[model samples]
Target: MTPPPTDKVVPLDELGDLVADGESVAFGGGWFANHPMAAVRQLIRAGRKDIHAITVVGSVDMDLLAAAGVLGHLSFSMVTLEAFGLAPNVRKAIETASVPFTEYTGLGLLIGLEAQGRGMPFLPYRGPFGSDLPARYPEIYATTTCPFTGEELTAVRALQPDVAIVHALRCDAEGNAQWDGTSGPDVDMAKAARRVIVTCEEIVDRSVIAQNPHMTKLPGYYVDAVVEAPFGAHPTSHIPRYSMDAWELMDYAGQAGTDEFGGYVDRIRSESEDDYRARVLTGRDVVLAALVDAAETLEGANL
Candidate 1:
């Protein structure tokens, strides 16, 4: 039998160098969902800077990067913890004018990425005219008349990110990744970005991927590197695998504006995924324990 090619499979640490120091970096997943946190930690640890971050509605991933002082510019719709209220680090940075950022509507961001993916110079869209985005993000949002209807439309400039980092539920050695749920704008970002790095919960055999071709969200051709990282989306929900660690997120949020935020980043960088999980749960995470117990029960029953 012949072995499969694994040229794209790389170490977690390699993610820092895959993208240069000064470049545009986009993150996958929605607010507090399916974020590639493990890889983000590595980049923060590497002391990377001068990054222009583009996020399609992000949370802790963006906050952590902001807290590390790596980002020089940011483009996103919003970064909040949902019911947890505003993201502390982001609020502080914006208030101090430490990191200049532009706010876009969620649809505006998606259309911009779509333009880049389709290799178009710009994409024309409706709405957002009544919003303050036109005045605030004038550089990104411009007025153009539709060729067919002769009506005024908003033209969202293409968003061609230098690198896109996303988390996948599973992938093959060749870097073919399949996500489980709520893909969000990750696929568009992967296609539009010049480089893509995928960190997955597990790397399965190529045959497993072949059996379900439709599940393959990101093909190997677009992926520059793949890192097999279990619990890679720790503290965020991966869905069908494990839920988000709300307590840990709250804890981080509570210490966001203080010096303790740096301590949290240091601890995240210093500890392994398992150690972090153990520490966050602290032998008292009933929700997680119940989920694990239920999964084990189902597995045993199936076996």
Candidate 2:
């Protein structure tokens, strides 16, 4: 087993400057329904091109990035399901660009992540017992072999990234990051990247993390940049800071992931950095109150 070369250490802010043209990036998020808008925002601000993107499933994040005129390729397991699949904006961009996007089987992509973390060239995945993707992605299936089948089986190669940008609920000044909620693609995300930059809500004292180690996910040593950014993943919920905008999410889903994507773009475009800060200052309490309203308004369109 051979692993890809060791990735170099770099700061998160430097990420926009460091990533070489055509480098690959593995994003850590849930299904298309679950992604970090702040992380996506950072990438959009940089607006790099010819980069590969990986997500378990993505709707706005992928669509927004693609619309920003970046994204050379995409590799994923599933886009959307149990809600809505294939974000409309993403689909339109894919259709417009004719990008050679590939969907890896879930199990195969997991195996690839396992291999990448282990510093292995590749690893075998047994899922996709019967599927067309294996045949389409020969690289993943390059050396398909199976002791059970006694026939060659296809498998995707473990992949890593040049950099990964993820948001954490809290962290220490040294860059130890953590989440305050359920598990996410965080571990795979950090492992898959040569460097990781985590934005946290509250960058606390290191000892505070030591008292409750569960709060910190990746170690400070592994992190390059730890931006103490509160309300980072705005309109996207911050767990304790906010709850999922069920109605908003459903609305976005109902529109096939495009619903008001352009509207969001325009909204952001209308505001400059100063405007953003002013908006944040004024909107903080309003946003908090909205989060408090939660399910009451979830039933109606007051928001």
Model 1 off-target regions past 4 Å?
1-6, 272-278, 281-303
Global lDDT of each model?
0.84, 0.64
Indicate the TM-score of model 1. 0.90
Estimate, for each residue in 1-303, the C-alpha lDDT of model 2 and write its tens digit. Answer: 866423233333444664555877776666432255655665555667887887765555676666665688887776543354556656766677655587877777767877887888887655576677787877676656777877765556878877776767777767777787633676677776787777666677767878889767787777766665555555455665665445555655565454456676555545543355466546554565466556453466676
What tens digits encode model 1's per-residue C-alpha lDDT throughout 20-136?
A: 888999889887788888888888877789899999888998888989888889889989978787888888888999899989899999999999999997899885868977677
Clashing residue pairs for model 1 = none
Q: Compare the candidates by lDDT and give the number of the best one.
A: 1
CA lDDT of 233 in candidate 1?
A: 82
CA lDDT, candidate 1, residue 97: 96
